[model samples]
Target: MDPPSSSSSERWLWWMDDEKKHSIADTIDIEKSEDGEKIDARKERIRDCMTVLGGFLSIMATGGAINSVGLLQTHWENNQLREYSPQTVGWIAGTNIFLSLFVPVLAGPVFDRYGHIWILAVGSGLFVVGLFIISFFDNHSAAPVTLGMMISSWGVLCGTGYGLIQTAVPGVICRRFDRRRGLANGFSSLGNSVGGVLWPMLLRVALERLGWSWSMRAIDGLALVMLAIGNGLMWGSGVPAVGIAARPEPESSDNEKNKEEQEEEGREPSLTWGQCIRDGARCFRKGDFVWMTASLAIFQFVVMGVAGTLPSWGQQQGFEDASLFFYVVAVVNAGAAAGRVVVGSISDSLGRFNSVIIVQTMVVIVGFGIWHNVGTNERLLYVFAALWGFSNGAILGLWSPLVGECVHTPAPDHIHAIIESLRLLTELVCGVSRLCDVENFGRYLSAASSVVSIAGLLCVPSSAQILGTLGPDIHVIFFGTLLILSLMFMVMARVTFTGYSFKIWRVV
Candidate 1:
């Protein structure tokens, strides 16, 4: 013990000498220090911020486009790729989801240990390469041979660069917010709806103005711009050494005033994998998963189905883009982007679970009937777009937070992964359903919309359509019914939470 003390003293004495010398090699803040604390200067790389923001935007793009190709599935079947089946074309979009979700498990850890600059860089490269691949591959060979649905579009090139952004986004958000986590989350998620609205219009324009090859090339170019911006922004946001934060960085601080307040936030030290698993298991055993997963699953069903059908819905409603299929998708996405924030804020105040019920019910009642039926009128379609944008937007924000309610595990990773996988499938199904209905010329949609509205009312936690008839004046009535039902369920949940935080059903 005496000998060890002598050695420890020598190490401290050496550190003190280094500090006195102001040696750059030994100095923590020799380059630039955040909040005036000693820090490894290299930790504050500008590219890291851009990587974080880009990561968020990347996922937003994936979510928007995941089910989007279905909007084109019918078009593909009828026109340039008439020989292709709907399911085959649908697979391209499906593949996007599959790779986007399942393949990126390691990304979070990678970003945590290393920084997101290279990840985002690779993402940018993939986006460009994927787009270019689709362009040349779609054009070069003849219909059956070059156009073989199995070979080209679905080929490995498609999902590669297309979704690198998604893999990066959440990790960035996680790093940025710990206290007002929900607020940061709300804004970050908005990117999806924004991308949803904007991309469709972009695609619509290129489809008509540029035709197939150049149109896709144009999109690739646009993606390049987005990527460049992400790179620039992320690069500007400096990276800090892991586990070294007494105060926020001035350049890229979370912008919080009270250090104590920041400490109180959700960004607390995350539990170890073993500990997380233990908590997650207990929560699942309690049955929180059923409610949370059901809610998210159903929410996706409505949103994805709508996304898939939006362009065709517009087409059936007699608002065909003619040459701007992608453009129309952009319009729908734009509305969604605008309205989703509305949904998020409102849901936060009204109750996350309740707000979803209210929003989806309205979509079903008015959207399918008044909007879908009247969407045939140009002015009416404008109204419909506004209505759809507002409601669907709410769903994105409301669902994820509820996962804690559903999955009580110490670690949410398992639940999040399973939900992501299941939700992807449901979205695919919803997309396919919407496309099939759209091809049937909008009649089927009108009927389904009414039924789905009622479905939202009954589902409170998931997707279960109780009504058989496509009821009349349903929108106005459902508005009342939705309010009543939402309040009722909130009361029920509140009572349960108050009683025991629903711990009884916590495990399953």
Candidate 2:
């Protein structure tokens, strides 16, 4: 005989052990046909896209409230808590910001294990409850009680809820889309910009007409409806399938043992809580990741600081009309929403790192070139608001995709965990920095631009005091320096990933 036929050989192997033969046969039976697998994969992608849409709604609601804090700050100052110092009132908003940034570090892992629905459910409930509580204590006489309610309900409860939703939604997106991740992430992040734009205008009108009490209840009611829709969409999408690419079976007997070994190697062992902590700590030890984290931290610190204080800055510059001051925030956010969608789509072609570099450069020019000499020119201020918002908004929108690119990993949970941890650390630093010097609010804004720039505050009476003195504007100098530093670190990260090749189109 020439040689045993392949079928004969398999039959011989099958007869050697009945249990092993059945196990092998069952595995083969369970494996999908080629066309069937493709069909399933297409279905999964469609589901994931729907899930992303749900995530967008969730972010829109939470991001709206967070971004609208400026309006609330103005309301407190002009109305309910006008008797209190700005510093005292600022802490209420500051606490909420701090918690929103910081809680995600812990929530990321919980979301990975538990799934998105319950996390979102609890978050939605807390957000609604927080707003309701605040509504009850809106009277000026209950200023002290309102402050307590704001901190407990809005700051701790609502912030934590937003943090959970924010963390879980990104995790969902990261797992679902690989090829078109930039577009997916960008679209989802648009929730923040849209929320920022709409909420400020709504709150402005509510404050003017309804007073603080009804305004709080109206917002609460709105959040409840949006969140219900979001939760429903998320529930329908189901949990995302984990890991990168699915493995194909070995074609030959010689490869079977190797394939088994590869499978064993790829399997991630469950980690204890201590091991998880240790693993998170180990990520910081990597030089490239550390630089990436630093860049993100500095960017957030600078942008949030300036954006948060824009209303006050406009007022101080003699925009006496409350409506005009509120409009400044809305205009910036509207530009931000537009920038997020446009730049995000462009990044798919230009490359994420290249897009980030260009935007950062634009921010530097806008801060120094336009904003520095804006003075009391209302038109110039609006121009600065539009350009700065658009460029800065792109930075926030692009960062998730950039972080995904820099970290060399196929596991979405691991990547998300790392991102959340870095964000928490960045926010913690920003929050503490803001809280320390609440007295000179302008100095806090300057200090937020860069760690080095905060030193500039020591000698100057205020941010405005050093504006014309040190070139056309001190704030621009501080912001530009931060952007330069952030750009340097980002380039270092890019170089580590793709080497120094200007011709290379995509670094990731």
Candidate 3:
């Protein structure tokens, strides 16, 4: 072959690059075509549907671990840390709950930008490590680790891992499902309820047979097995790969090129972090986002608070049998699981906002009408747990779809979804704070929870303080009031977004 001229070599390289670009483009097109075809496929072939079962199980594991903190809290109080104040012990579980909720804000963006594999890998590792750490901690040692130390090791570490997985799983479903998005989300959320039901019984059994340390280890082992299986399923799901760039089409001719150049010059530059912050601030200023955020925040604050405290409250109610006390938590969660499926399925038909309103109304009625009056009557307490659990579960299941509806712009974009997700996740941080006893323990726990109808807003220590100082009757009233206020906010959000027409049953 004769030596090519520089111009000819340049032409050859350009042609190669063009060929490569076309190949990339073709790959993307094939991927998109496959996605579309899968969307139209029979239910069995849909990757999203295939993964839903695994995702549900993954979420069930996550929820089980997170919600099981109540059982752990009760165990620690009654067995491991009898001398410690309830408020002091409460921080351990509270921090775990707080971090699990808050870390999702950070995780969501990452999940959106990256795919599930690395996130799941890191999350599973951290989650397993956190569980192992909790399992190995020995209270009988010469220098027993303090409650604060446990919080750092178990709460922060495990919670972070939980947050990563929790955020990623739902984001996967969100990207996968379109027509059945609500139902898909609902199924995933049902995992939390399932966890709530199963973990208590499991933990109680472990506590009875294995003791606290070994019980944690047993749970850890279960988590390890489940996460391994879930991770495998996730790896195989063939969800879209991230970070691939789509090739821009070639511009034709000088006049066309000139128009494109001019349009590019006119377009807004990519957003800077400062600009994004400013934009998010502006979005939050809008009434719809604010009200929706507030309602969601209050609901989470109350529900999580209640969930964390419920086992302890059952103990305080003179439920001497530890098994029964744990079962109370299970019953509530069981009801919630049922609610998640039923409410989630219906939300697609009934307006998301309307469904939430109905659920919240039921929560208020349960909190005040049933929960407030239930004394030592075990049957009534179980009834209250069932009703409250169902209503609250429905709220949790519906909130995501509701937020999606409220913040949804006409033409959907990643930035908008990220903003909405961030807003919703960030708002839950407020509820997380309410789970622990900060400086304003009694007032914040009692007043905010009551006003917002945050069901289980009382931290263990604070619940102890309130139950001791103010009485359980007062605590019940606080929760009832919180439910009432939460109901009002839900109503306000619905009215603000959907208008006053009763005919519009479906808000989302």
Q: What TM-score fits each model?
A: 0.60, 0.71, 0.74
Model 2 TM:
0.71
* Candidate 2, run of 10 with poorest lDDT: 432-441
lDDT of 1 by residue, 1-508 (tens): 2222333224444445544534543354433445344344344433443444554565554455553554554455456565654334444444444444333433443454455667667866765676676666444236666455433443344454444565455545556556655655556666776666666666665676777778777877776777677666655554443422323333434545444454564233333546533432333222223233334434444454444334543444355556544544565667676666676656555655556556666766655466536634665656666676666665555545444332222332233465556544754664311112112211222222222333322221121111112222342243335434443443343323322233332321
Candidate 1 Cα deviation (angstroms), residue 272: 11
Please write out the lDDT profile of model 2 over residues 1-508, one tens digit for every residue: 2332344334545444656765665565456456688899898887877887888888998898888776676666667777776556666666666667656656655665566667788888888888888887666787787777767887788877887787777767766677876567767877888888888888888878998789889988888888888888777776643322233434557666755665665422334667655644544544445566667667765676565556655666566677886777888888888788788778878888778878888888888788777787888988988988898778877765665554443222223565556645754664311112222222222122233222211212232233323433455677678878988887765543443333445534
User: Residue-wise lDDT of candidate 3 within 1-508, one digit each (tens)?
Assistant: 3333444323334435656755665676688889987867755455666678778877777778777676777666766677777677777776676667656655544564567888888888888888787666546342247565678766788877887888778767766777887677777767787887888888877777987788878888888888888887766776765611111334667867755764564322233445544543444433444566677766776776676667677666666665776778888889888887788778777778878888888888888888777777889989998888888778876655565565543322233565556545654663311111122221222222222222222344455556546666787777667667877876766644533323444444
Clashing pairs in 2: none
Candidate 2 lDDT (Cα, whole model)?
0.66
Window of ten residues with lowest summed lDDT in model 1: 460-469
- Alpha carbon lDDT of each predicted model: 0.48, 0.66, 0.66
Question: Candidate 2: deviation at residue 173, Å?
Answer: 3.9
Better of 2 and 3 by TM-score: 3
